[model samples]
Target: MKQIGVALWLLFLPFVLFTAQAQESKPLSVDVLWQIERIGSPQISPSGEYIVAPVTRYDMDTDKGESQLWLFSPDGKTQRPLTAEGLRASQPTFSPDGQALAFISKRHKDDVGQVYILPMNQPGEATRLTSVPTGAYGIKWVGEHIYFISKVWPGKNWDDIAEQVKHEANSHVSAHQWNALPYAQFDHWLDENREAHVFRIPATGGEVQAVTQPLNIQLPRSSQSASSYDIDPSERYIALVSDSLNDGVSPNNDIFLAEIGATEATNMTPQNRGNDYNPMFSPDGQVLAFQRQLITGFYADTSNLVVYDLNKKTEKVLTEDWDRSVRGLVWTANSRGLFGTIDDAATSRVYAINARNGKVKALTGETNFSGLSISNNGILVGTNDSFLHPAQLVKIDTRNGSTTRLDTFNDALLADVELGTYESVTYKGYNGDDIQMWVHYPPGFDKSKKYPLFLLIHGGPHGAISNGFHYRWNAQTFASWGYVTAWHNFHGSSGFGQEFTDSINPDWVTAPYADTIAAANWFAEKDWIDADRMVAGGGSYGGYLSTILLGKEHPFNALLIHAPVYNMYSQMSADFAVHAERFGHYWEKPEIYRDISPHYYADKFNTPALIIHGQKDLRVPVGQSFELFRTLQSRGVDSRLIYYPDENHWILKPNNSVYWYQQVRNWVEQYATPGAQ
Candidate 1:
């Protein structure tokens, strides 16, 4: 009996050890993802001694996330939260003296977000700085005054606006009327009657004074943020972004320059038909720099950096010859060069552009860098992340492009999470041109084993898949489910130069569709990929492409379409129509719409698919997904439709997102089957 018991114990010991090892090397899941803290862009002080960023944490039970300001030392040694937990805080701006910090938050009796100021060098509670009924955002602490942007009813004072808001909330009428082109943006409806303007208040707390409201010029109706306007160092002048046309239909964004107290502002870019915004004044206030795009309808047009000499009142295009778009521009201390995050060849890199001659130099290579903030002493701090890691605050050495991690918010959560490896591979796509793609291998991946393929298509048709950590459609998360994932940057994807981006202009079908097909063929030849168990899909334009696949021949065993644009003609009902301004409308170019619209080939629907859409998605209306789902059901094809009424373009709620991932896993596993065969 003792010998038999010893043998049984030995057999059970091996089973227990295997279970412990499996738990130790757990893959990323939706529950674990919610536990990771998300760090926003860092704001460096004028002296570069102090840096502050907003860190947000989510609660699964509450299905909400709260942000708090966090302070970090320049040497990357000290880090702590500046605000109490459970309260939301954002848009941290440092005072010119670097002794105080100001941010927007809603606390205590505040019904909306108000400006709160805190002492940096001393221990003290934050004090409310503004009581405006409309609330404030996009704050900047410049000179002796704090500037902020707020949307208010036109010609209404603080008292009247407060009363109006109360009455509206109590009113029974729920209908919204709009007599304009842009009635909605992404998820929410825009108040056409209200106008967004800049306002200023004394740092010590006093009466609010309207800056642009008195000038009778308002920021763009569709959107307005910190990038909408800029104040000069002397606080003598202001440059703002305003629309050249007020009718809303095909409005052109142009920069307007005005004196600090003047009631009239001059239109600076009236000759340019395309959009020109993000007016940034140089350190010396000698030049005002902004971005310009020549094409009227294409939102992904190349953004060229242009400078205006304040003294001479002349405009010069600094990046006219460059193909890449200039984003997140920051003027150097000396005003001789500017650093910007540019999307280049499937990567978001930091590039230095000479202010005088437009000579461009690459600063950082690999991964993704965003929310660039530079101090007067030339300390660059930004948020950096990659496929295997979440966003981390880093101090970048401007000269050498070296980076030192500043904050360790998500370090502990990610320490034990076994992440998959990814690589950028180039393959011959449409027209025999090389297309770049990111391929992710599952954790403990072996070349000797055959795995299923999860092909993810990116939207924007113009938005390339750069190296960044994405929570919504994470490649590693899918790869963890025992499948190899890949994102193909097909034709029309940006960051590959202007010609490649514009190749699919009027016809959004031919080139991209062919490129996707080629990508699958390239993967089918891979020794590790099991072509028989391949699945493909995407969101938005990616979904449109998936619908295109539904009507055509492909190697995919299943499709996952999210928020797709099914019918080109019905797409005009969306807040922003596709190809209406650049290309003629469907009535004018009926052949183009008929030939490319996915709904036109509904008879060919045969593939099993999981369709997901949100009701509030105005970009690609929820009806698009419903239309495709209905078509699939009518044809007796295996399909599943998951509707999210509260979600917008993306699944955001904690519980809803977890459910979405589970449904996706279940649907994919039923068809393709995960793990090595």
Candidate 2:
């Protein structure tokens, strides 16, 4: 008997060792999260021969991050960095012939990001392509010219613009003057005086020629990027997104089509009432595609794809019958199909839409994919990420939906990190409607033992909690601390359909609040959950929901709210009003504002809460956090307020983000003990 036992132990030694090794792995930490290299969207060559993407690495000591352009081959064999380390490089664009690459970089004595071209076929250093004093961005290379957008004085030349920039820097006056409605965006104040226009220079270097300047039309005042404009393959026409009304307060974005050097442009979508933007010219130069939304005030309105024929001068709405909004669009080589990364259900999937028939077919599944780029041969490259991993550059198979990872970024960092498990679940919510949610269990989770629950409310009121790896409010990170974290796709969450997303407008409290309570009750019924120990919170819209919970009777011991819109009346001071234009102004809809605002229910505030906000949060305004904090204190509830002076709406800086995570962990652990008991 003793000899037989020794022989059996030897047979199972390898299996026992592997299990021990898996059990010894550590859970995800803030430090490990920072250590992972973040990869940007892939920019594939015209023939699908080379792929270049920006890889960013953070230094905890410097409290900064540096990005470098990295090169990858589609066969998954070659991986190397194109740009030098410790320099800023982004906006990678390949030449039409795929012989060279152009990107924005601020190196050496450059004051701002400028266009730099690197030869892909030859062993040569990157050559400075532009010397624009106003700097260059939103770059695209077409035919024999390189196009870029620059904010400049409309009538001033390059030298004059440079002189003006120098004068403004040397001047002591810090005040800004604005005469328009969109005086500020999310974080920074906008200069209403400067106009953003497209400019192009010869590939061999020459005088810059204005593309949109001659038309006397400026890009949208609030924001402009590469997606704001497109140059046709023939280089004969340019399509740009500009405000049709030119009234900043309720500006309607529309597409303007013009000949490359024409003095006047035609408004293509003059009949549409809502916003229309993201003009993309098909490779064949026959069609122009753009996204359109019908509602003026709702930022999260469903965006449908529309295409216009250049020859026929007719327009068609391709995605009018579809329920999902299309984003990150890329035209295929044949120009017969358009590839878009869509927010479908709870995942961000890549879909191929037949441009001719308006039929949509999902090309990727499960995980989130974005930054789609296609080659002339129909090859697709993009970034794929999930809850357990950061984004990796991938070459997606257009036919079978399989992906060949082009870059091995963050693989070593995550090798020893035992990330938690998560799954999609459905529960009875408001009106007994099924609400889909993501529930994450801690590493080494045991069903026999009871664990604490941390319910996370997602913001966006329209932003659905997708399956992409979240950096700011990572559910897996919360689960790593030994608590089961969940993100509920409650009422008003997008991706389910247009009707479900618009269900909670005007009255924001009823459905979402009931769904949240139902989520807690659902968890309470689970045998593995400790019914007495529960916490919930979110940011932006999520923060608003958490504040609502503070005033209502719920199954939560603590709440964590960040950058919340506490008082609806005072939210008028925000950069954008929530329900003013489309629904009605607060004065016009007094009862709706009064009932839905979280501040009105402060009399019932009793739950301990942690309120976090940034001084530069123009979206929700820093005052919202203060109002919630004061109300909690006035009600004699246990509460804490954390303020980030150098941050914006998000804790972007590395050290600040680490400190934020630490503080949140400290706050949550103070009330509800983590781990199973």
Candidate 3:
């Protein structure tokens, strides 16, 4: 009996050790599952030998995001953290001498971003420059002083006009008393206050100077207001966009150039309509390059690059025939030409356009290039896939355009992890429109077996599904879980031309819905996709579309809608008051709003839908999701509502984001199965 007992004890020892090792090797917390960090705002030194950027890291244990200043040599051999302390540091701008680095930090615990300067040689404590309540934006070194945009109080002139409008609103309320209380209250607050003005503070901290007065220059009547102004390198002139001449009643924005230290400002862009923004001065200050949007409403028109020659006093179109819009413009150091990133179809590429002849040459081929920076040595391009991976910073040779990867943020994490294969595809829509889409095959996908399909819709009814890596709760996660995912940059999506984007504006909801359905039909035709196990999910405008699709009895087995807008009337009228002007008057466009709203037809919904919304989503109010959830429950539909109390429109908190992902996984497992309950 003693010998038998000893033998049993030895047999149990290996089993206990195996169990301990298994527990140690359990999968990481969901919060750290897809976390990625990269070098943001990489700025090469003036001498082109050193690179300075804010390197961000997401801490899963603390559930907080941290960043610090890091310096790297040109050869990518030596790298070290310049700032050891964990604080949010971003937007590194090097001084002309390259002896010091200037950046913005929120480390003071006041929730205000202040400018801090650090010496390159000494590496001591960062010195705070600006001490104000409103914080600083657009920090640039202009001569000896650092120029930034700060909010300042508008004078009595604007206050008097605001008071007059208030009194008139109050009088109208008194006349109708109970009948017009809501209208009166909204009108009074919306029309009462003047917007924030831009002020220039000294880099070394002194009395700030108001560059643009609120009353003197009026804002465009559009829903989006101007926030910052840019000064030329010469410091002789400042460029701004405002609607002051229109008495705040016109949607038109005109670019104005004002002489520094003078009240006189001249309207450089005299257009009565369209948006002119991102004005950049040439190296020699002889010409200016800016972006101009030529349309109004949702799917209005494509924006193009326009160049203004100060010496010739004329403006010309640089990318006139290029249907894709130019963005992320960086004028070459020599100022002879300009380089920018343009999106065509779904792929983003870098292009260099001749400043004189308007001839464009593709630089970085088909890869999506972002966080672009140019130095005397060459251009630092951050490139990545649109669906799966984080961006990798690479140095491109100017003469040969040979790419060399400097730093990969997720190389170690993605080494053994399998990634979905992406391919560009196209399908015909209901109106015979050629809809372009991208499909993500499941990791280690098998052609012999049918897999679940997830139709991922991008937000922005005006936005596009690009070739760049998506950093949010992306479709790659679904692919990792053995589900095929497809994303379409449907009509009304940007990156194509203005004509394509503007098509869905007035009747914004239906056209994209058709494109999404077309994508689903295309996927169903494929033998590898299981047509019965289809799910639809999205956030923001994408969320709105998901809800709409659920109500339409599409083939989708389940739906995940995040912060969606169900009722167009409530969304445009009350929830998004700041954007009310974009939809025009509710009375004037009542039929248009009613026709596009998904909530009006909620009784038709049959799909099991999971609703997730951030409680503090000021952009798309939580009330929108609440209404949809309540309506779905009333109709006896299989619906679940999950609210993140401390989250905003975008889930940024680490713990909340993890919870959201877990809920999505659970929903997919439960309702997305064959004959699921």
Candidate 4:
């Protein structure tokens, strides 16, 4: 029963592609991927009467996109747009009384993103609150104050900060200097002198007060967003997550608690030291809840829920044995329980945790839920999506775990298109574990005839190809070209368990390589698959693994490596270097680097590879892809490098994304002819 590299559910697809050769709807195409409107997270009002969500659309002619806030009733009967067509509004948070909403947007002459308050009950225009020349974001409305996060020069006032910003822009000094770690993030460089801190201004307009600066705790060096800090009900206490270590690789983000006007902050979880973040105070203002992880360098570490009693000065781990990282934290009105989201077996679902006994229960299933917001009455709102469906706003009934669709976003657009069929099947992978793999069959597929296989390796190594729909990497879109596309949640993929995720730790290559190769071999043996006409591809860590395949004997006819980390030494130039924290630098441990780095295997490279990289990709550094492409060319291996100068780690622009899809489609089809034979 523990057959290696073989699928156990081949017999489940007994039907011959389920009505093949019949007149089918149009296949999912690149145009459809671009045309479909993107639905952001939903923010339900405190009163539970209204929900505001952001809907984004792109114009091909202008090569631009705009996001607008849309208003919907809980009953799904009334739907309307709140902002004007051209205005782009995001991060909507309703006021305590539900009469106003605070969001971030730059309208008209605003140079950067500023806080805008839109009245919920009246028809007046959204008014700009902060004119801090440097801009403001991560907005929260609590008790007569509007708190926001802004990056500003320490010990500088608004006018001085404005001058500093302008001087930095106008200065002829094109050089940047950093004395500490984490000098840059994904797409932009982080200014070493400027610190990101939380500040609060009066709700009706008053002088701004720096909340975190006087306490002397800077936010994480790389970046800080809305999840970095939380303010209690009465604004007496503030809980924030800050990194204690200067070493960029090991993220030692610890939770700190301080009274609003206190001189010093207390490090609550300083003893364990791995990573603790997303601190939120309970509704009663007595308990502080946050997530904690025990391992550094391993980002997929299971985060246990920690609850601290503000009054009793006691702490406890609520979800110590749950085996899932809790995120999207929100307190149920009474503070008796909480509803959070987690990734389970490659699917995201909401789960409720009892504060009294630390018990956990699933509240929603199957579909991936995100942007979670809850009302005082237990009404929950979030965006629900799956492999076959795009994100849609929905309200979940907490009692019975049933969902009610609140918005019909893309019904008409998807009605005429035929998405391919897919199934969640398990295959024997590394260490005899039942690895979850998602296989997508082309529309109008005929199982009687053999079809090419398009194998896709997911990045994150920890980031699994979940049940949710994706814009960049879609299995159905690949399958539309007469090939069966599959994604194997290999050993290192998250949502499986702690041990499974940590399988490819310091080595960072062996288990995932074995699992992916096993996945390819598994599909090749299928009666309906053409083993000879197979292609494989991936980005980031996926690209890194594909690079490894190039150095070894593999079944794939070709490979697509995008934004990869090909050389361990050059990877140090990246903002976040992989494995440096765990195995030390390549100079300190040359043997480990030589054994695992893909550049060391260039001598054995023979596979035809399509290398894709974005110049602005700070995570992997585009140089890695360039190195791989050069190696392939020098070895006389058929390879091509596609580079995007304007994109970041992901191809975000509509035109750029469309072009990328077409390029990938052409490359795959040219090497492995599509369609059944």
Candidate 5:
């Protein structure tokens, strides 16, 4: 009898241990979350034989994102890490010679980025170039000098004007001064002194020279800000985009050609109604190529690539009829044509256009190609399935267009996990408009069993869901965990055309919500989706929509809102100043803002919600999340708020991102279970 009793106790011990372990898994940490690896900003060597890109990997154990510079040959035969410091190195550009490379590293303790040069043959410590307080960006090689864009303090006169405006805006102070101050006033203060100027420093070593002064051309208060300037191949003129006259109200950006070493600048495209940017000169410096957008009211027309002949003084559109934006341009060695990517919706394809005749031919048939470069031997292109796929460097034969995949950033890790396949689905939306969405089925999915569904909304009512793979908390990992995720490019989303993108203006919130609901209904009608256990979530604009959807319906068992806008009056009044121009002033359109606000109808919220917002999120302040949490708490609704300190609008820290996803997974499992909350 004693022996039998001991055996029974031993059997019960295992069960007890299992139960304890399962219970301990509560309050999920970052390790259990999904991991994503990505490669960004691929740059081909000047010789076009090698490609360099910033490869980022997240380690679950340490919860940190490690970025390194990686080099790959054109044939994809040889690929290796260029730097092993475990520091963040990005924007790699080959020196004029293929033997050396220049990159930006933030390894210094000063918290400022400095230029570093490393020899390809003898890999050792990189040579530091600049030690300025503010970091450098958009570094390019011009002869033996390196040209970059840096931000410095504006002149005293500008600072005084900025200070006066701040003083006047705050003439009336209340007890809730910090909360009541309009967010636009703060934005105006931040931009008053910031300007992009061209600076040059020696490649080897020397003091940096400021080539473009802020006073050279005053920007208009209503125009968009200026960015880095590009140097012509001859290094005689610097090309830059600025709205010095518009005062930040319009999107009309004029390209300026300033002679090297001279402060005088000439407006290349002097259109006051349209916007132009990303100016680049042909190899021979005879033709200038740039992108222009026509803005009408709240909508912007599709941007097109235009070429201006310096000698002939003629400007012509290279892709006039193409209903897409030409993003990146690289001139061929002969300078007769150029290779660029035509970005349409979320799909991008490589195209070669004749500079003289405005004729275009697709180089990459159906695959997404970006970060393209051309050389005498062949063309190097970065290819990916969707935004989530770590792009692989590929060499396409300019002669025959035969493609060969070269080096991949995180191919080894990606091999361990299978990726879901995306299929384009079209459904009839409100007013019979064709609504397009991309559905991603889980990897190794068993068609025999139904899977849970997640409806992911993209932010930017103007933002469209694309075919590209996303690295941050992407749908692939959810699919890996046995869930089918669908991303709908609802109305007001960009890339389809101007009319579709502009539909959200004035209406602001209802049109997008209707589109999302239509997508949900479509998924419900599908056989694979388990309508009983559906989850809905999104970040930023998507987050706002998710919260609103919760108040509108209780179909979703679980809801996740990341950096959502809950109160429109408070948000529009306290949000970024750019919102005033982007969405219009709430004072002028009070009814429109109030009727579309999610907070006004918070009492209708019924679904359990998990709110996530960055503590330092400037774009969508954490207060928005707090307000919703308070409302839900008062109403006895199930809601929880997770704050990530040191994170911004987008979570960049690896461990934090992983932890965020784990929390999401746990929340979904809790509510989306069989007969749960």
Candidate 6:
């Protein structure tokens, strides 16, 4: 009798824990989204024994985020923070010997971001390395030197720059003048006089030396980061990105090679009119690998992998005819191949490209993989996540593509949170091509009942909503609102073939517009979806498309357009002039702008809309949103506009994001209440 009672108690324990877990697993909310930890890409040591990554946490009440560098063993044991509270470090790069880690941080409250070094094997705190007043970014550790990029005033030293920055700050100069095309980037104003160039410092602590300043070529003004340059293992030759054209309206980034101390740099591929970037040297330092794009204005052009033979002084387009774009470019131990993440049919996969024949083979499938770090032994480590799962540290086997989770971050937090279910489906879209779409259902969804639909249109105009966990503008959070949320990788979305991506280039309407409406009609046919109560919304280009939907006859009851490019003529005031080079200026090609510009079709905007924009949004100016709101008002259409004074491109502040979501919910509820009937 006693043995039987003990067995029954043990059996009952499992059920009790399962019920407790179920009770804790509540629906995902904005609060939960903010509470979850964000893990960045892991940086594997040269020896492949350790991995370091930045982990960010947000405080809802404080409405602030804090990032700290954390170290983890490859086997998923012994996780610890390398830096303590109040200190934020980013872009961690391990030295060749794997003895020290170099990162960028602003240790002093008033100090600009500078390079700092922390000993990997020692128990000391991080020591500041560079004191550049303009701040150092895109840090890299190679051989015996630490390389970084900084935008500095010409003919000025460190002290002079510091004084200049202080003077500029103290001087209430409210005017900004630009003589050239690119006066601003995505969020910040670019100083036309200040040049962004690569500089180097000895790893053992020495004076900073300018590498590209004397070359008389400035890095691309609007876009330049760590990927723009790479130092060879020999530290003899440096490969950097620059453009011959100073027009600035067109980005003509090309790879330029220069000796370590030479004053001259030669353009490697001046023949290619498009963009070339992400310079990486082979392990043996004989071959240089970079990504090449074909189109200049179309940012979504397929990136082909190109390898430049140093001895031969010739270039080969490896992925010439391939349909997908290469991301996170990395070299193998033998320099025989490259590894990176690629988007394919609404999924991000890890692929290995054979350097010899350009044969592409996917290593991992389904889940979105990012922050790829490869070592000499062919060990690849990155952060992988799915729609239902948050990012986790992972190790990828370059040979078989098997993945091993290296860290169990947010597992407990997620285990206690009930998440909705999602799946990838197909539908015939524009051009009769098979289009992929992802549908997210509520946590306690029931197919027997009818639920309101929240159609989510992705931006990038070319980027896909892949199988990944997203904190901002999350589909799951929207699904938690008791609606069937979906993301359609319509025409012009990448990951499909090149033809499918470039199909909507100049038109920017016809195909994607048709596909979006088709997706709506497809979901309307489903018995479980309440077609009449559907709401559609998006950000950036997504907002642009939703604006297009407003002019067309759509089933959506309400629309949410955030940071939309409404007027083509007004968009020229943005960071990059849209369609000026591709379709010619509006004056030159009036029909192209007249036909597609949303403002031109304002007479048909009858649907209610909620408009949102940020003052710092340079990609799609906030003025665009103002123009849209005014048009809706002039037409007497029901509309509301929300403006952010401090935020940029996206709602980044925790409080601001929460408020944005709340207001959006209110707007959706006012127009089309969510829930299943």
lDDT of 6: 0.89
TM-score of 3: 0.85
Using TM-score as the measure, what is the rank order of every candidate, best first? 2, 1, 6, 4, 3, 5
Residues 278-349 of candidate 1: C-alpha lDDT, one tens digit per residue: 999999999999999999999999999999999998889988888899998999989999998899998889
Could you give candidate 2's per-residue lDDT for residues 490-540 as a string of tens digits?
999989989899999878999999999999999999999999989999999
Model 5 lDDT on a 0 to 1 scale: 0.71
Question: Cα deviation in Å at residue 362, candidate 1?
Answer: 0.9
Give the range where candidate 1 is weakest over 10 consecutive residues by summed lDDT. 407-416
Off by over 4 Å in 2: 1-24
Better of 1 and 3 by TM-score: 1
Return model 3's CA RMSD, one decimal. 6.6
Error (Å) of candidate 3 at residue 158 is 20
What TM-score, over all chains together, does every model reach? Answer: 0.97, 0.97, 0.85, 0.95, 0.83, 0.96
Worst 10 residues of 3 by lDDT: 180-189
Runs of candidate 4 exceeding 4 Å displacement: 1-24, 246-251
Better of 2 and 3 by lDDT: 2
Candidate 5 structure quality by residue, lDDT tens digits, 10-68 = 99999999777555532111332234455665777767777787777777677677789
How well does candidate 1 match the true structure, expressed as C-alpha RMSD? Answer: 2.6
Model 5 poorest 10 in a row by lDDT: 180-189
Tens digits of lDDT, candidate 6, 196-314: 99999998898999999889887888867889899999899999999778668776888999998999999997888888888999988989999988787877889999998999987
